[model samples]
Target: MDFSSKLYSIESELTQEDLDSLKFLCLDLLPNKKLLSIKSNLDLFKELEKHSLLEEDKYDLLAELLYIIGQHSLLRILGTNKWAMQETLKKNRTVSLYRQMLFQLYEDLTSEDLKSILFLLNIPKKYEENKKFLDILYYLEKNEQLSEDKLDVLEKAVSMVSQELLRKINDYKKTRVKENTSTQSLYDDKMKLSIEVVEQVSSQDRGMKSTVELVQHVSEAANGKDLMDKNTESCMSDLSLNEQSETEVYAMNRKHRGYCLIINNSEFMKSDPRLGTEKDADFLTNVFTWLGLDVQIRNELSTQQICDCLIDFKQRDQTERDCFVCCILTHGKSQAVYGTDNAFVHINKITSYFSTKNCPTLAGKPKLFFIQACQGKTHQGAHAIESDAVSSVEERKTKITIPDDADILVGMSTVDGYYSFRDIRKGSWYIQALCENLTKMVPKGEDILSILTKVNKDVSEMEYSKDRKTSMKQMPQPAYTLRLKLVFPIPLAPFKPLFQETN
Candidate 1:
């Protein structure tokens, strides 16, 4: 009944290949360096236990991993069967989109077909030694000829090998296109709402001063109450009285854009030290500072310190500043992340600290939380989705009301119950993509949500496919309640800092 005993019982039922598959399924969940040394099921469980992912009462992750690798016979050791797992994961599968794609390709491709495709690819003859189709795909990824976004090289080679495989690739591309279109449509809806609000006001009052007056009137009339608080005032006042931009944006012209808090937890008391987080911290501090925000970095904090830090910010009077930003880089699990002491700090608790009731000053201002942590331990594998009839788009009437939780954005490194990846050498996939997108996209006037959409696409395309079995993938998730467009206009010149940088 104990956790180690359960793992030992499972180990007896598994062969070397089964163990390898289990480890492969865990590639996205566990550290690669630790996984390499897991020659037995017990060893793998030990690593999971170290991360607080497995316990005597909590063996669901282990069971899911076994089920994912098709070691179904071993599932009963954890008191679950394949049929039950099938139903449980029907709506929420753990295998990543990238992994499922490669697995499906391997299952359909013949050995001869692989050889022919490899020949067409003109891959080095040395790779000809690789017999598995997945191995060949790994080579393509390693050589930078294939990725989630780029499949031209594989598509061309596969076309000559088999039309079915080519169709599969095309289906995957269609799904990606549809997803992108859906995201763009959401952006368009927000923009439309902005335009509708403006047009409604413009129909009656055309001047810049009238625009502000109309916003307050329309909002009050639509909501049937006075909701124009200090935050709403800040949102509207960001626009110049004499000259308004073509599009409305949240105020970012203040000399100080409030605090950009970077909580970088690299060292842990129990868990593996997070390597390469220094790069994320450094990059965020520099970029946010350049964007006219006061950057503060806090390295290696316990759970108490994290709570204390949030309380400190929540209590601060941010009336003079324009917005707030917080970045958390650490190990995590479902709905919560770990501190240096390996304790849980629920994300709800963190976000609640900045609620309008909790922190009145930040009520209307944007409070951005960029969390570089995994939401869960599930691995996302790619799969083909059959095309369905497109539904007709509908437009709805717009109403503006500032809820208690408005102006908040939480950018998660991965979706719920999945892993987010990091390189020991180059920092995390989410942070790297996020910083890169912000640096590249902000100057072009894209709002934060749009920039985050680009970040989602960039991180999803990345894979740590060292080999076919250990191919890993990640997807970033963004959730926001922002009422107005949040854009950080590039300052004419980087503001000289007056505060000392803290490590």
Candidate 2:
């Protein structure tokens, strides 16, 4: 079969991820502009064919690239196996030292390291948007900002991120110098052969053969460098998350932290208006916005609207987000919170919208729901200690049901069969305390559970007074199926500037 037909057969077997790897490997072989347009393996093979590196008779470069990328199984299409290629590479491998070094650096640098490196780089905002290391390197090459010989900017950037990475750069530099020396020696040997060919006039055929061998050697060396570049690019693309450090902390590195959807049902059609729900919504928006979330408040949603809003949020492409937050401020009953239309939306139904089967994007990420409503009509009375703190408490109580899934946290205004307090002027006792603790404790590097514990403590101490005596008390509750600790560290830049909303 012809080379193009063979490539077509190979392409059919490879996934999009495999194609991406193949394209990455070609970074050194082709220009950035060309690569950006070459979407498929056919397009890539055409470019290689034009360069005469992937013809039917000459495909060792392709074989070597496949071997480097651990796709030696694919080498069967090129009529080669890993064993034969391994033996060939042992004597003379073509992939370059510089390319291999960069691949190692790309593999070694953690996601945090990539961010740090990107911060240190002086590239344009457009290029910096792509977090992929290969793309960044391509941008550097395209802009003529970095190259094999130009190691200053890269070394400086690596030094700031990691000493080990910097060491790799230095090692590459040392090895590069040695390669230069060896190339100069090869040049000297070629010159010596030229003189020998000149002196051997009687043996014209032998002199011609010697010159041909020298030319072939030079061509092979060039091909070797090209192949190495491709191999390095492709290998870098294959980096997996499993290679990263095994940590208990969930990854929270994203452009936007996640969405904070607040359903603030203040005015109800059938029931009494939630007096201080506006304050709760405002506080939640500010707190979540300060924590780097995109806060959106939906006022007075009905049962259907609430369900649709949650469904919309769950169906959204949350690939770039690290967490999902939904805050509900309304009236409540036994096992559910009441919509503005006095319809009961069960807490389980609300949480089910973001379950793994429903919302795969948020499968392993933290999903936090904070409810500010009463669970029952039963008021939590203070038995041992009572203090004078008069706040109008909500008579409607709501039960919080946690879904049987991992990485979910439900913060209830009060425990089952109990009334939760809400001041006419301020907000719900649970929400105000929750927001206060989030603002105070998040900056102190406290986890969400720890902050919630503090909220419980703060709310449990307060008492509402009817006439002169303290009459009502409330205790906030937290139900969690979290696998990892969720901590929102205040950004280095001040929190005040991160969020600006009118209360």
Candidate 3:
């Protein structure tokens, strides 16, 4: 029999309920299939035959059969099952079979009824097709064309598509020639060109290394003669050593001392810019707050406002704080960030405020800056590295200096010339990972530097294949000249507050 004839024959032998059950079972098997497993197809066929044995048990049996099959495998054969189940769901709107299917395909249902139809169709699969389908379906459902029941069914049917299939679909769509109106196509092309241009100008791959070398060269040159002369002049100008003495005392009292200021610059000056900055800001704020630091979460700020915030933060309680942290989450160029007024401000200008000589409060403290901004635009295909136990010597060497001295740690979201992942909903990947690691590490008694090293590993190693294209990464570099170890204070939870005995 032909494929259609065979499908029809199976349907003829079973009641409508039994046919529905088999369809549901087939959908469920799609996503749960292992990479190399052949059992999915076999198990699904077996369950369909099993459900066919009972007449009255047919309606509920369809869902049970689909549920028996895995989500991964069911999604692979979604093309056939999706259409059939959708038709069934459309006809029998009130069936619980449809409801079960919708719940299963929540990720892929587009149009509420379609989502409901997909969900009701519930092909068991580990992966779903495009999220856009579901998003679109949801939009339609909100318009009242698709009932809640039908939306549920469609959701399940669409969800049964496999990750591999989803990837293939997305890749094909990206490569397709635009057939829309020339005007619309032209506008899209222009937008893409602009993004590419911005990316090229901000490429970090070569620029970041160059920046490091440049800074090293300048530091060496300055140290050779300029620093000594400046030190002598500064000593002559300022005789009071009280600040230095106070820093030493604070360092002795706290094993680790430092301050971290996390700023989220996710929003832009333009009211309706393509990217939103607030999400990034909120992610950072939550992280620093969890780390028990005095975190200042700001929205779109002017360049001057940023500088002033930094200046004020440093001035307050400078003597006791041993370290300083500043994180900027904004749309950026290679070495610049955008102010709320849409002006480009060089990063160096903002960081220069906390230099050893300029900011006395943070003079001897370890100042660390974490940035989540795209440095450049370049598209490099993902490459997998072997998971081998390499020696720790390969790790980047951290700069060491006196505690009553200067140190800087700067981390960028991407290597130059690459796009940093910004989720319109989830914020930047680096900030989320950084904050997540810090929150988890601090409680385990790990130091801040150690936490950052893990952050680097997490960002670099995450994979984003064409199928799951949302993945992105970042790079962090720590430069220091601290003579003492700096640690931030961890406040005791309110639940553990001390109770004084009445005298």
| lDDT of every predicted structure (CA atoms) | 0.70, 0.72, 0.47
Clashes of each: 10, 9, 101
Residue-level lDDT of model 1, residues 1-503, one tens digit each, is: 77677788788767776666666556567886788688887787788898887888887777766765555556767887655665554334445445555656775576678778878988777766744565566567668887778888888888888897887777667655655665465556556666777677767646645656777765545442223233233322321111133244687766567999999998877666777688778778877988878999998999999999999989998888899999999877766777888776878788889999999987788999999876654333233111100111222222222234888898988876667777665567888788877766564445798789989977887776645788677788888888888978655552443434343
Off by over 4 Å in 1: 1-246, 378-404, 493-503
Please provide, for model 3 over 1-503, each residue's C-alpha lDDT reduced to its tens digit, 9 standing for 90 to 100.
35344434344334433333334333333332331132343344445455463233233334334322222113112222322333333323222332333334442323553444445544234333543343333334455545533333333343364453334333322322221233354455555655654455466465555666655544554344444444434432232111121122114244334455655554454522425345556656655655455566666677777777877875675666556678887655555655666555566666677777667766656677777765553233233211101112222222222233356556666654455665454445677678677655454334566677777767776555544756434454444444554444443431121222122
Each prediction's TM-score versus the true structure: 0.47, 0.47, 0.40
Give the winner by TM-score: 2 or 3: 2
lDDT of candidate model 2 versus the reference: 0.72
Model 1 residue 340 lDDT score: 88
